[model samples]
Target chain A: MTKRAGRERAGRFLAEGAQAVREALRYGQVYEVFVTEIAAARNSELVDEARAADVPVSTVTDRAADGLSETVTPQGIVAVCELLDVSLDEALAEPKLVAVLVGVSDPGNAGTVTRVADAAGASAVIFAGDTVDPHNGKCVRASTGSVFHLPLARSRNITAVFDACRKAGLRLVAADGHAKTDLTRVDLSQPTAWVFGSEAHGLDPEVLDAVDDVVNVPIFGKAESLNLATAAAVCLYAGHLR
Target chain B: MTKRAGRERAGRFLAEGAQAVREALRYGQVYEVFVTEIAAARNSELVDEARAADVPVSTVTDRAADGLSETVTPQGIVAVCELLDVSLDEALAEPKLVAVLVGVSDPGNAGTVTRVADAAGASAVIFAGDTVDPHNGKCVRASTGSVFHLPLARSRNITAVFDACRKAGLRLVAADGHAKTDLTRVDLSQPTAWVFGSEAHGLDPEVLDAVDDVVNVPIFGKAESLNLATAAAVCLYAGHLR
Candidate 1:
């Protein structure tokens, strides 16, 4: 369950915490729920909801729960849910807004971006080209259950994804702080896929060239740039608000 | 050096990584710089800048550098600088845009909000009433050197801080997602101090009451709310873009 290969082989992943597990039960293919006795006693609401949904509830010892938790302070709720990831074609099939994380390895940033994409009413989230697996436990936790609610795809072949987007009539806009065009000036009303890169190295040159244009989130202060997830949120929301 | 009390008593904190150390040397009161022998050899530009500034540059072993690092992957550069924190009065004085972080305990969020405030052309940043210390090492690192570039203040008494902001002729706008007024509709041309709260419980009711108005960043999608740092950045940049 800890290894990516293990989760992949099992065709399932763990969704931890009350909120995320709750969301999985509500909108996702949740198969099993694990709860500590204390948690079962304290969080009757979540346990009841799970039982009402016909999901099996297994009681685990506190020690067992501790072993399964990823955080320093465990929330004592976990769900084994079916893998919900889709293909790039399914993600970008009918997109007004698409959030593409290009080589964003940090699970927190990737998950937060997925949540932001969902909040922005994006059609799909594509983790294209060397991005972290969307099913990673930390990434799933960070998505705050949005991972269960959206079509997420990961592909190493970024070029093909860009070609598909172009063929689908979606403009490709890379979020580069060094770009000449400011975010405020970008016409986000167009069907567009916003691309963001890693915290260490930004977008690759070929990836930049594959896009229609690059846009910079306007920096008014001395800070160099926004965090990838925040920048993605700002860009995607700009399109949504448009 | 690792303990908060030690950092405060010494009136200095470590700024880690190339970018943070470089920024500490530029706009901060950098008293000393530490670089691993390998870092000194590899990062000649930063070493030369430190030497040019007449700051004592001590070469440490790789092991010693690891002790100074707060991140999982150490960047091999650290700066010990005089505490750059200012008084709340100093932060609010003559300020067109000021960002106030209330009860934001996470160093990453506090540091990021400070950087965002600086990027938004804010005159100052106030970490008020149970907020993380601006000089905390992780906060300093997350700021990417904006910690040294702007006026930053820590105050436990938020009430007086709000009074001072009002007296300074700055509107106190709390960025509450549940507020009726939309962020886009807010008049950002006026001098404003944007207030944000912790990741868990948002702003205290009293804190919200003290504000001139509460403005919500419009959410077009299903995600409940923005991260504190991201929400602060969006609000600050909105004022900047205006």
Candidate 2:
């Protein structure tokens, strides 16, 4: 079953939809792929590419596809891509602008932030201890296939990441709803690292203490908080503008 | 059932989540509320406030709550609130700045635009002919309840909205990915309406043809397109700064 192959294997991760699988192929990360038999005649281009590239391909029924696809609207093509291995020691070596995601369990939000990091030219994005897996299919899709584009690393040892950032001489800016300073005023051009927490709760107090600065986006309405992806885009764009 | 009440009934739309239901009462919108008996006892503040406000309240089982909640994460509260009815004729009477959502189906995206509209201090937000219902629970929560604070109106006929803008000496600028002019250079200070379309498919060709001018955000990356909410926020923030 796809569920068994997708989750049980530590070396393998599933990617759903055409854009995601196409991106995996583009990035040379595909280990194996599956396309539901129903799409054999319809998705000729992908089938042709998979055949020409000599990537292992399989076909299954829609019922199997249902168990395989992460999204409600499946695009028929699903891929098993190699899990990327990244080390904090190496990421700190050339750090200019590093980003941290804390307790952000939503894979889509995590993926969009990674894409933003790539777009804004950040040095790296680290998924802190409690954040979602950066390689999840929804995140891969939201990044518009950006999962293969940048220096994004996941870390279970978040304290070590903070220590590494300090050693790298980067400013630690935590995005908070209660912070005093305006994010726009902070010098984003400086060697900086941004820390963001989950949507339900902002940064945990312990993690919040590890960062050097806390900043906020000035809100002028009744909305409780900005969507995490939107806020990430804003901060990343601010850096780009800088 | 909330499903049966879909978009047509205005006086009472389904307000899901404890947070949203609380906001509705705080904003004085709870005409009636229906929660599972457990839900009422779990969050008594909302139930108590409904009673103090002389609004009707009822209790049902968890299964009944499941039938009523649009979102999966229903925080034990579902409210029926009075809808705001702002007219284009009323809004464009003396326009300064405006935004229009053209056939945007995502309630969350629609809500962000509403919040940004208020944050950017736009005179109003116009939902063109076939947009998602503004009162959707996710939409309301995403707006952070800004939908209550913003001057938003759904137009039955959109051409009349444009005519009203013209009568008020307002300019209509359509945001296009392939537009010749850079949005950063455009004079957003004028009495204007910035228009955005659906995420997957853009504006209907007929709607695109009627706008006075087109503007594009400069792109420096390999991304196929920006998410609709991020694009809207970027443009609206620019207008907010202007």
Candidate 3:
């Protein structure tokens, strides 16, 4: 359940908790829904909904459910859903706002950024240049079904992503902490693709140079900077609010 | 290294990664610094700074460093630092802007909120009523060492927290999705303490009732709600920008 190879081989992944499972049933290709006796009793409505969707439901013991669960406190309900990866071109074919994650390896940060991008009305999210797999269980759970809600794409070549964004008529904006221009000065109303880097490294110098512009989220306090996910939220929401 | 009891007994916690270790040395009571040989070579500046501060530096094998790391991909650098905690009264005594996390059990979320609070120029952060311990290794790492930048407090009683906020003359604002007022409409320039709840359950009814007002971070799109950490960032930065 934890390994990328395992999820890839099965072509399906587990979605835990009622909200995620329900979302999987609604927007994703669900193979089966697994619920412990207690979870079935607690979430009869969701189980019934899954059944109505023609999705198979399996009843497992609490111990078995615990074994299948990854979280410390199991939600007792898990859904097996087909992978939700879309090609970069397909994801960006028709987009207004886009979020490009460059080598964002932390599942929590990746998921949080996806959720924020979705919340900010971004049209698509692209995991570019060695970014963590979007299908990782932790990423899926952190996204809270956002991975299903929006178009998601992945690419190894960051240059190709930039080319696609340019072809899609999206301006490439890098979110850099050291940028001279602040985020507030930038006009995000136009179709724009915001690029963010990994936790350990900011955007590569080459990637930064290729972007149309680099902007910084203003830090009014003594703290060095915001976390990766928080920075993405602030930037994306700024675009939405603008 | 994982247990809260052990950290409490030792009155120290591990701060992982170069960023966190650097921040700890700059702003925290770092007792010792541990780095893998590769990290030592790659991060000579950090090692030199640590040594310059008269702090003990230890070179350990990658495996030993991994044993001390809480993250999946060990950053190869860790710092043993004194617990960064303050009394609730001390934290609230002179706070202008504050963040009060209620029942936020996820260490990642808790630490992210602390980091956001610091970046937003908040005077202090309080983990109130069944919240995760600030000294927890995961929480410390997630803070990116902002856990040391400002005062942090913990309380088992939410009511006591509210009482302290009231005594401090800070407006209590609870981040509620169902609230009538949107965050943009709220005047955040005034002294305030924003209260957030756990990922599973938002602010308890009792806690909500005791707060001065309830506000929601408006969702412009289909995402049901923002992740806890992201919401904190948006809300806190909104206050900062205002």
Each prediction's DockQ against the real complex? 0.47, 0.37, 0.47
Candidate 2 ranges beyond 4 A from true positions: A1-10, A60-74, A89-97, A166-169, B1-11, B59-76, B92-97, B119-123, B166-171, B240-242
Chain B TM, per prediction: 0.95, 0.87, 0.92
Instruction: Kindly report which residue stretches of model 3 are placed more than 4 angstroms away from their true locations once superposed.
Output: A1-19, A31-44, A56-94, A155-160, A163-169, A240-242, B1-22, B30-83, B87-94, B156-160, B163-169
Looking at model 1 chain B, report the run of 10 residues with the lowest lDDT sum: B233-242
Judged by lDDT relative to the true structure, which candidate is superior, 2 or 3?
A: 3
lDDT of candidate 2 over B193-240, digit per residue (tens): 888988888777777788888877655455656778777766766654
Query: Model 1, B142-175: lDDT tens per residue?
Result: 8878888888888899998888888888999999
- Tens-place lDDT per residue, model 3, B22-87, is 988998899999999999999999999999999999999999998998779998999998888888
Total clashing residue pairs per candidate? 4, 1, 0
Of the two candidates 1 and 3, the one with more favorable TM-score, higher being better, is 1
True contacts recovered per prediction: 0.49, 0.26, 0.68
What does the lDDT read for residue B170 in candidate 2?
85
lDDT of 1 by residue, A49-83 (tens): 99999999999998999887878899888898888
- Model 3 chain A lDDT-worst window of ten: A233-242
- Residue B228, model 3, lDDT: 86
**Ten contiguous residues with the weakest lDDT in model 2 chain B:** B1-10
Best by TM-score: 1
